[model samples]
Target: MIQLQSSAMQDTQLVSNMMYFYSNSARSSNGRQSWILLLPDLITQSRQQTRVAVLATSMLLLAIQSREERIFVESLGYYCQALISIRRQLPLVTDPQNPDFLPLTCVAIVLSFFEALCGTLFNGYYQHVQGAVVLLQIQGPRNCALVPYHSLFYAVRNHAICASLMTGKISPLAGEPWLTIPFSLSKKSSSDLVNDILLAMPRYLSALNADETASETSRMSREDIVQDLMNHLQNLAGIWSQISQHEHPIAESTQPTIPQSVELTQRYTYDNPYHAKVIANYRTAHLLAFSLLSIILPCHDWDVAPFLDDSASILSAAGYLEECDIGCAYFQMVFPLRLVAQHSPCATRRRVAIDMLKRWCGEKPVRGLANSALEAIYRGQCVIPQSPVYRNVYPDMSTEHSKACCERPVPKPFSYTAKGQWIKLDGMDTYITGDTKAQRAVLWVYDIFGFSSQILRGADILAHSSKEPILVIIPDWFRGSTAELSWVPPVTEEQQQKLGTFIQTKASAAIVVPHVRTFAKCVKAVYPRIQRLGIFGFCWGGKLVSLACQGDALFDVAAQTSPARVDPEEAKHVTVPMALLVSGDEDAGLVARYAENIRAETHVEMFPSQIHGWMSARGDLNRLVVWNEYQRGYQVIVQFFDKYL
Candidate 1:
């Protein structure tokens, strides 16, 4: 009997060690503390059965730690025994109304963790997650107020939210009762606020997907839903701001606090590491919230500047976390950091975020989550919620520009008030704006939807915004073929083939280059005072700008927005200073690859929320979001010209 007691104590100690290893070392720690706290109760209730489960869990941890085939098999045997025992007790323990339901759920959660570690072919972990969700729904919030129950409830809720996002499925927990649960005022912390925001994410995603499928008549109501979500986000941001001002109240007052600093070295030796971790967590929440807001709000309504600012804060916080040797805290930040990496216009910040992700991957195997982060960085695309009206106007492009010029929205015509007169140049009608007597000149190239009022308005804004006196000229580059054409939905293969044929024959580089040169010479002849020259192109015109830069020295500088057919071979010959502004949805990998080959000083700026042709094709001029991006792109062009011309 004494020997039996000694053996039982040894097994319990082993169980304790395994619990510590998993809780402290695993990539995910949800519900781990709660399980640890319930260990004694579990042993007391069913010592033999609980010992088998604990032994299985310990062996699973050892298998992961050792990566040995023999140990993994041994762990599987112990797991099978525990699972059988649990199945026998399921009738009583799985009943949500029973007092033991929460404890049993915790046991199931831990077993699921072991199953995931064991490399189960089927998604065994998700089964456990779904089971927990059903139990929580049956138990309700009132029943979740007990010792281990509250923590388990939060852990399960959080896991469901994250799993739903990762799997691209609407969360089952995203129901009215779950979202409407009022926050406990006394228990409020930054973490709790973050949880509240995260719980709302699935509803937001559902609304966005719903808006995509809504009928035209109901689109306006859907827009209101998006607006309501935005207001909620704004309120959350306000609460976060208030919370960040104070040190985390839950942190012990006796612990020394380190002043927030950006220096990596100083962070490494900080007296109070938890204080820095709290700040990092707050920043992570802000980054994710703003990133989601940027997606949900219309491009014309969202502000990219503040998003950029928040991204910087996240990067700084991540660096602080890394240097403080609290990289586990930094691991929780990968998703938001990856969002910033894929969408931020700033190259340096994006690179830093990517590097951080790579570093994390190198540090530990994180079940391919890190790999997905790298993939998102390279792809540089995310779904943005849009109204059905907008969807009807601009459908998804089927192929790259090689097949056809990518489908773009037909911008509503605006009044072109810029002072300019049409002049015949190289057998084409040209509209000139700005000072005709100015020594410098800018040639504007139109896209497939040639010489629209929207393009003219953009030209007028450019002409007026430039600091120097210059003549702005718009050439009818499409030769009137595209004047009456607009994007019709259900774009077919035959239509794309015909469009590609037309581009190859009528608007190819062989045909457009000489005409552009003739027009340039004609402009110089008409205005002898013109010495410095620049070319600005949109869409199809962007290709012309590239051709002109490569084939001739007629222009000192060139700028293009949403350029098509910019092959890397052609980019190599670019000899003039060039500025390229592209949409976030464009192939960033292709652009970055081609930019490297360009011989001249090249600046490529990507607008995170803008679609192709956004600079000149947004139908709504009054939208702050669209107008802001338009103004920002225009200023970039103007600055590039002012510096080079």
Candidate 2:
């Protein structure tokens, strides 16, 4: 692995310089864009350089190399970055343009080379794979006028590739003795495993840097390279230590350095890197959703979901086989996977085993796994109705139907927002990520509501605004709210009046509530730096749109879809310039009475064919009604957001 990395690095400069030349000139000449004409020439060049990288990487692994190999890696890294940049500049094509082929071909080869080097250099660290995925993912959205869903999808795509590699699904090289290592799991925690892997790297690097054929070779000035690499390893080791410490607080940190060995056996002793990532992502998503008062899940086939292979019996059969810690604990709690562990006499082993089970199967926050957890470690306290959050808003909430299916209690504290081309006034953080492609986004989105989200935070109009920060409004008391699960009969005329008053009180509290109300609360604290606001919502959130409209007239414009129960009288209070998007069900007699007034009052679009929670339904197949509606609605929603706030 080390040898291959060394070899890949050998060609970085040469390849990067060539790519830069191609890119520097490719622009300003669409007439001359020719994949057929120039592609073969580039391939031939790649064929030779790739061979050098392969051999050099092999030599580096075997502990033999010329100083030349060391310089090669940096060069390769540079070129990969360049090719990534060029590919990003070209317009993404759906109809297969000629120029598209050229850039695509280059990106493929360039990324392959980059992956080879980074993969080998880092000893196949999953983070590098993830970074490589992100690097490739940023291309399309760079050309589009909206936020890049491609980046998100691309990340998942590469995740699949990496998963395959980790699982021994596909080999990087054919019929080669190399690429055989790092194919199994590591028994040591990832942090410990990293140190162990790096211990063997120096030897392969030494060979690659040394001139095996030069009998009298005495290499000098390579001190910096060696030190730089050691630094990299040390930094990685540090991160490993930190993550490990989270779960293993009681475990003593040892000074034992990872053994430096070229013949070490790869440990498939039960730790898959993807499992960790899936767990980490699950944890991150949980926090993100919890903070934003939303729910998120990885959109994929269950077969590919991390850790659990059988999918069924994940909860029942999964338990700890090893010692556990906070990191593992947090991971288990966050992802909806089954836990696997075993009872152990060994302390570390027992801890690990227990930790894994508790996390994946625990009930409190495992909202998604509630009913699904008959085989789980724990069970839900209660099962609520899968009704829309509009019961209080309508006399007959049955009019609007969204088949969300799960009746798990909603976590308390709710909020919503969308920032269309938001304006950033001054004094905000500047983050330059991926290709620096976002540089074209001079239009800052300061909208507190909507975000140009690829993650699909909102169940309504789907779009990404470059100007907006992800605006999320959280309702107070998210976990089992006063209104979260009311399995009551329809509101009576008298009850409707009473609840209308209740709605008024809630509305007044919301209207008057200060300090961390909408996502704008965060923005306001962070702003003067932030300017402009975009408001949006789905289901009951539509009501929030109305409330925000009444109070914040400065919100240039707002869009609401499938709103919750609205005070019929409050319709007269809406003052903000806005766009009202609602499903057919939301437009009723009284709600309908305000429709004309709403259209006259602001921008309004009614989707008569759609259900209220159409945006969030993850229906299996049946594209015409479910998928197409979401897609078309997403399109129009994006378009509407594109035109205004």
Candidate 3:
């Protein structure tokens, strides 16, 4: 234990001693524990060292221990390492590709699982696969003890996927109430959750694919992948729910969440030492089942490009990157099939599919689409009867007034148009159109809510600003899945490319600002004589707008809320104006810091609260409402546009 800093300590002696200790420990190895005890505790050690060393140590230690010990230690190491990496610095964890954050080791818990089981008549709930992994590091040790917490997190976040939620996947009414019974995972529960979720997903995808197919191929459509995925999700959900919750369903009425005889299997049989190994097997299954379900359920419900994109956003929030990647691949795979479904006109199945997607994406169509299937509920043509939102301070306010919509005759906003169709910068069909509308045009953005779609609470800046001859830059993939997109087969790569390309074409709506340098070109092209313009965006689009404005002359005014990315240096570069809108309850501290950085460097409007979907839409979870109470963001947007745009 000599000090490591001294030059004289170029210590072969230390290495020799460590090796001796390692070898001796093998003689009476407590397995992983003995090895760990002999070494510098990796958990407490500083992380200037490479991660391979940590993985290597854990792998070898696990090899020496009992199955139970090995599994637990392995999980512990992965979780610890994941936490460590997040705490240390790296680029912010907004993008999935960030290296400081991909924690495959923690994902070890979900490697294998037997996702088949009878319901114990109970229930379920997973977040950010990228930055969330880091946030979970800051989440501290609450759920880090073993596999259960990760399993719980995975299940909770992916509750829809786990149960195979059918909303937005089938006819919206297919599972309107989700169940005939009051299904609860606890005494407070009762539901046919498993069945409803599984059934709704494929039904919707089938409808989507069927709608897109030509009259000839409509009759010849092949395998039902939506049903297949739902079955898989149901199987996994039932099995893991049974095991984790300790219940088995012998009755048809009982839709158990875990597996039958599960706890015993995981606990011990007194049946044999092999019981422990069996426990490891079950633990592995439990973890995998939950993780996969988290990913698959949301995907199962929404195959439309907008919904798929939304699924990605939800996955990022739930911290299911591995699942997100898998979901993205699946989306690519089945894309073609769904496209065919979407091609069909006014078929009952297609209608069902659209409804299901609406539920999942929290999309309640404001206006009816042109398709006959949606004719019954079409609100697009008719002025939708504004639903009254209940609140504490104000008398119940209608959603119409609650949203701070930008004023009509929105002063000319800065406009930029792109030459080609919207090209996907990162899986979005983004188009920007702005030309000397305001001294500087300000843009409003959202993740899943596109300009043409229903409004999200107070986020009607685009629609409400009908008076303003503003150039509206609408990105194609804002919602990930939309009514138009649902009809496309999202399972095929060719289809994905085609659809992605089509969406990208929308960029022709405005000047294509592909790179930071080209952005200035867009500004120059649009505002050769103008002096100011503002840029605004939401969700993924919000992130994009924020990034695009970084140190560029294209945007004179900018407002990004619920943004996915932030570049602080952009503050110094931004010459004109900017603002950030955030509301509801979720924390925007990280983004707020960026805002502060901007304020430190320049003046910008900023909303320090959480507005779910920027009050652009509603968020539904197992029927519980989170952001159904407000719609003032629209008003805020309107005011911002008035002041800056």
Per lDDT, the best of the predicted structures is 1
Give the clashing pairs for model 1. Answer: 300-625, 300-626
lDDT of 3 by residue, 15-110 (tens): 333334233312211221222222333322434322333333333223222234544455455544544553454444444334322233222111
What is each predicted model's overall lDDT from 0 to 1?
Answer: 0.61, 0.34, 0.33
Q: Candidate 2, overall lDDT?
A: 0.34
Q: How close is candidate 3 to the true structure, as a TM-score?
A: 0.29
- The order by descending lDDT is 1, 2, 3
> Top TM-score: which candidate number?
1
Q: Local error of candidate 1 at 593, Å? A: 9.6
Report, for all candidates in order, the number of backbone clashes: 2, 75, 161
lDDT of 1 at 198: 56
lDDT of 1 by residue, 1-645 (tens): 112256567566556656664444222212224345566567567535565766676666655555656666876787788778777876655456686675567666666556444435354655666767777777776566555566677567655654554444556566655644423322545565555665555555555555566666324454665565576667667765754553332232333232233212111222243444444445544545555555555465655555556556566656555554432343355565675565454545655777777765555323335555564343222323222212212111111242223445455676656567888876777888888889899998777667776678777777777788888998777676763244322155355445555565666768987788788888888899999989888877888888888756888888888777556667888888888898865666666666788888889999878777777653356678877888788888878887888
Q: Which stretches of candidate 2 lie over 4 Å from their true place?
A: 1-518, 527-529, 598-601, 617-622
Question: Per-residue alpha-carbon lDDT of model 2 for 394-493, expressed as tens digits?
Answer: 3333222222211212222223343332232232222211111221111111111122232133322332332333333222312122221221122333
lDDT score of residue 290 within candidate 2: 21
